[model samples]
Target: MLTKPKILVVEDEIIVAVNLGQKLKKLGYDLVGITSSGEEAIQKAEENHPDLVLMDINIEGNLDGIQTAELLRNRFQTPVIYLTAYADENTLNRAKRTQPLGYIVKPFESDQLRSSIEVALYKNELEHRNRKNEESLKSTLNQMESGIITTDENGLVLFCNPVAEKIAGLSYAESIGLSLTKILKLEDSTSSSYTLPLSDVLISNQTIEKNGIFAVDGIGNKTAVSIQISPILNTEGKSSGSITVLRLGESDNTNQSYLKEIHHRIKNNLTVISSLLSMNASNLKDQETLDIFKDSQHRIQAVALLHEVLYENHDLSSISFDLYVRKLTDLLFEVYKVDRSKFKLVLDIQTPKIPSEMGMNCALIINELLTNSFKHGFKGRESGSILIRFSLNDEQYFLEVKDDGVGLSDDTIAQTRNSGSLGLSLVDSFVKLLRGKLKLENENGCKVTLSFPTRHET
Candidate 1:
């Protein structure tokens, strides 16, 4: 019930062509017209595209069968099976360069011919399946929530899904087969091991998961993104390079842009609230209530600053930590109007941009500590020294704020401190929000050190 596969025979000898055609016909194949010369085979192939071609090496044509096969392959993707009498080393070595599907030696029987054709057809079917698999894989990569791109062993991109294209600010044509540095637009362009998973796959011949920092995109946006990549191995577990998945905090094209606009307005409203509090604080005769209002205003601005940054960038996933910290510090100094001559505020801060969630938490904690130091810690004087150092250790980050002023009471911040404590308790809450630890040291002054683990990075 199956339809026979059409095959063309390319033999320079007339007798050989006739016999091959008869044998192929008898074997249940559709006998496409045979050609005696390489030139005729190429012409016939152009006119009538057969399923497969059986080529002869030493033909009576201007071009040999190998040359004809190369032409057919380059022009038409048709699979070729070489038909020859002898398996000479040079002939076979040269034939391999053309990637022939099958080779038939001379003085072959009907079974040999039948077996070669069957094997060639099987190989052709497998190639077809591989192509389909690639297409399907491409579709799946496109549908993923994260960006996905794969490269060959040489780090040349083989595939880049739609998400990868969109997130990386590039089209597939510009991405495929390109060196990752060229595509990623890394600053150093030093082919760093950003693709750790891809390397693991190459070494262990298995899947690997990795993370690394990507520089700002080619558009010179002054913003960098993190990339999470993994390896894709073959059936035999050979290193086949890797696929990188980019996570940009769910860019909901349908409504994310619209929602970001609304959040921008809300941040402005918070700023107005801070302004009103500042006016009210100026009018208050009682210093305690005035201090309370000022502290609350600073906290509101902390929340508002995060909103403002996210509003401007509209990337809900990550905010610029370096920008957020710098801006918040500036705002605090301006609000307090502290004398720069008498007291100095030192900041040794460093961190890459992070998500808005992490940024807001960090800003609030810093705001509270700085506000507390200016209030109770420096009760009698308007001049003092405060040093803020930011450092990371292993999986944890340390925020140590040291002030040469009065510190907390012994019983107030004891190891047995309870949830009953109010302001200190609030500080504890902020620490918990960061999933970190907090310790107050009262050596010469007040030393507030907050230690917490880093969040999920690329």
Candidate 2:
């Protein structure tokens, strides 16, 4: 479905114009129109919009066919061939200035004209396709989210995408053709100033990635950005330019701020609840009721400490269970007024961290076990040692707490399990809540080991 190439004829002689039109049609070209004067030829060319113009150098107008062809070439980019009887040196020199596609003497053959037209049309189509591809490439670069810049080996900017321009706080027009260093300021997180790695990449032809780099824009506004620099190589496998991509870094400021607010509110609420419990215990004269209230307050304190740790920690998702266990045990000793100098505490915490949810549960379990050890095992005893060990093995989280004090008898253990001893019952419930198994041994002293799978939260 290819349309024939359209041709316009500009000749003063009527016979030559008619004969040329018939020759063009026979040669499989569409004849747009024929005109005798240069002015008429321009009018027909504008009206018909032919692909090729065959102009007689000597036409009937003040503006010769050469002048008209120059006008057509500038306005429409239409290829022209000079059809003239003059082949003298002076005439050729003037015709060359118009930049005609082909020069034809009078009485030219059909094959010569057809060959010239085909060559011109093919060259024009190629130029059009090249221009289209360049425009498409530019559009793609501008639409990208990551900042993209291409600079020559001399560090002069060649291309800067819209994202790159936005990051630098400079327009593309301002960035392009300028020194890349002049437009951008880069500094490391530790405040060390340096140029971008693009210059090095050009020299070594290697790729480099730099993280935690602060990008200071033209207006002195700063942003954290990670940059990647790679060399742009030519077809000869030599470094021609460098392409740098800048990706904005993650922002933790907002998340940390929000978590701090939440933890402050929660910690305050827990402190109020603990105070209310202590006040109620003071009002109660009965020793048993006061002990119960104190136990409840201790449990609340364990949870409250979690919020405090989360608020202070850089990471909000988990806490260092080792550090937390030490702190919690010290708090318990203070609560019970037990002399910590008499009872030595040994901790071998292999599990460095667990999720906050799991940490809270572990905290309560440890509290209950330690309370029981201090209350029952070390009763009437002045010197004792307690060991707390936490570890992870084969995806299993293990917690072991041992006490070197009065060991439990077989009958006493059975009674504690069977009877609803509140402390032991609560420990059992907590083990079940964690989907774990617990064991109690009283060979040398009371030793409790709890094992659970480290289940990841969805």
Which candidate number would show the highest lDDT if scored against the true structure? 2
TM-score of each: 0.48, 0.46
lDDT, candidates in the order shown = 0.74, 0.82
lDDT of 1: 0.74
Candidate 1's displacement at residue 354, Å, is: 27
Model 1, 72-91: lDDT tens per residue? 98898888999887867987
Steric clash count of candidate 1: 3
The lDDT, on a scale of 0 to 1, for candidate 2 is: 0.82
Best candidate, TM-score-wise? Answer: 1
Lowest summed lDDT over 10 consecutive residues: which window, candidate 1? 187-196
